[model samples]
Target: MPERSLAAPKPALIEKVLMRCAGQCAVCRAWSHQTICESCLGLYARPLPRCWTCAARLPPAFVGRPRPQCGRCLQTAPPLDRAVAALDYRFPWDGLLQHFKYHQALDLRESLLERLNTALSAAEVEAPDWLLPVPLSIERLRERGYNQSHELAKALARRRGLRCKPEMLLRVRHNDRQAGLKLEDRAANVRGVFAVEPLLAARLRGTSVALLDDVMTSGSTLFELAGVLLQAGVMSVQAWVIARTPEPGDE
Candidate 1:
């Protein structure tokens, strides 16, 4: 008699093993399910109604107002035309980001990219002409061995059938990390830190582009990059981030 073929392992089993190896929070190791569990997700990742233009967490008083941008944005507008984020960067979520950015756990890129893809689909926005990941300084890239944002953008572009231009935006200077800094200092830390490749300027002209990043804290980095892209004559710029840190008043 012919030998029988072996049955393949179940997908559920594979997922369970992967989740276990990734630990509870992927970065926090706090007893989560592949970075987050359903209960913790409900408690920590609850969605806050946000301003459409600037992505600021909106209060009930501001809901249904004529303009959706927050007062700050109204006074001093951000450079990018629009922005969207999947979750608030807090608690277990922040831990996950740390793993991807600092711990070299590149495997987390897949899950983060999946979440960003969902945000894009739910927004119903048109796919941009090109996608660019916020670039890192060569020094930082050499130290980290990878740019988490670029990895995420590459995965997103491949999944969505859009072009990913990881090198379009280059980091012109190395800046200190923005974490733990006040909002006021955030902008200064990122100022003059990015530039567009001169040869890529013509391609960006008259084109709409999407900028991808692992997390957006004060949005200073995104704003700086968008400013450069706009100066390069890009028709429009939008930001796509894995998470956004809710402003103090938002809580």
Candidate 2:
């Protein structure tokens, strides 16, 4: 009658596409959000019982102990008062992170943030007043075009209603990537690389902080950053990371 619908109703096309998108899981393209919906998350982000101070896997013997921190933390405390990580840095998570951190796949950052968000929600933990990303040095920042940790903090801060102070902690020096270093050498690699902005001294003073990062390998980078915050008069320090690597021998 009215030239019959040559254009296939715009609204119908939009609805069809939107429906397809809605049906696909964020991490895995699938048909079931209700059934295997969290498939990707379940496979890649299932939470593991971890050392309270460092997020290291709890030793088999320490499974139900009263103290949750690892033995090393018991001997000598870590800089952060507490810490937690979403997943162990391996498998699909590692590959996803490589894309986010190195390949300029910015969208993947949100997936990592979701994993961290899930970790915090499932744990009986306190939220910090300030969330700061482990900053990048000027040289690296220029090259990467973005700081994965900062992007993560910003997204999580919105979800948690916390302040994301990406610039509060400044990377004064550039350190080599900690990926390939031996466990013993990792700590030394990041030494003296992070400092807090003097202008924020009063702002950060008395504020509890949670250092944010993409991965916690030896716990050195975050540990170093936490110490700087505490030294600057922050009341307390905690760490929240997208992933925590297993101890060397556990591999």
Candidate 3:
């Protein structure tokens, strides 16, 4: 009889270390199981009252304004119906975001979800029928090996028991980064860059969808994705992102 080879043993040291450090963020000393420490999390992530329509930070004067809409959204309505952000993208938070998006810190998904979940819980909004992550271009996906937004959406859906539709919307163009661009240029950069798959369209008909993304800067990308969903007959499109960048000259 031929002798059978045994399967290789798993690494026990790494597992032991991770277990000991459970719910602790090494960077911020936050008691988190995944990424970011609690102290850093509190210092970096803080909630802000924002315009429901555009997710822009609400100025003190605008606090009492009924159904407040930002200047940009008031002049030209965004494609999406509503937007929600978990925290402001500034300071140490921005550092974490840079690391996650550019350096590919996959473990950051846990912190992202924790922050998003808190925001969702506090908001006075109904859950959507479907959750769709802003999709990446095929070429980009091939290079990155994963879409960070999709990963976060999957975790969120699991936590809330909502259906996560990863293939519903897609980025058709590999456009340039919008980080440093002017707001006007950002809109043009992302215009006509997203489309909904035909099969996915059928599933979205008359359904409410929550678009999940890691961050909302100029919000051109979310607007573009919402346009595609609306064209596909989605009843309403709402956006939920981990962070929102405050525009200059806006309080």
Q: All models: lDDT?
A: 0.78, 0.79, 0.80
Error of 2 at 86 (Å): 0.6
Q: Report how far off residue 205 is in candidate 2 (Å).
A: 1.0
Per-candidate total of colliding backbone pairs: 1, 0, 5
- Badly placed stretches (over 4 Å) of model 2 are 1-37, 60-67, 249-251
RMSD of 2: 6.1
State the lDDT of candidate 1 residue by residue for 1-251, as single tens digits.
Answer: 99999999965456447856635654435776565555655676555556665676778776556547777887888887778888878766787788889877665666666667777786666789999998988888899988988878877887899998787888888888788688899989988889889887798999999998888877888988888888998989999888888888665
TM-score of 2: 0.84
lDDT of 3 by residue, 1-251 (tens): 99999876554334335544667574655566656665676676766668877788987776556667887888989887778898888766677777777667755656677888998897766789999999988887887777888878987898899999788787777987788787789989988998888776788899999999888998888988888888888999899998888789752
Residue 34 CA error for candidate 1 (Å)? 5.3
* Local accuracy of candidate 2 as per-residue lDDT tens digits, 87-133: 89887777778888977766455556767888888776688889998
Arrange candidates, best lDDT first: 3, 2, 1
Off by over 4 Å in 3: 1-34, 61-67
Worst 10 residues of 3 by lDDT: 11-20
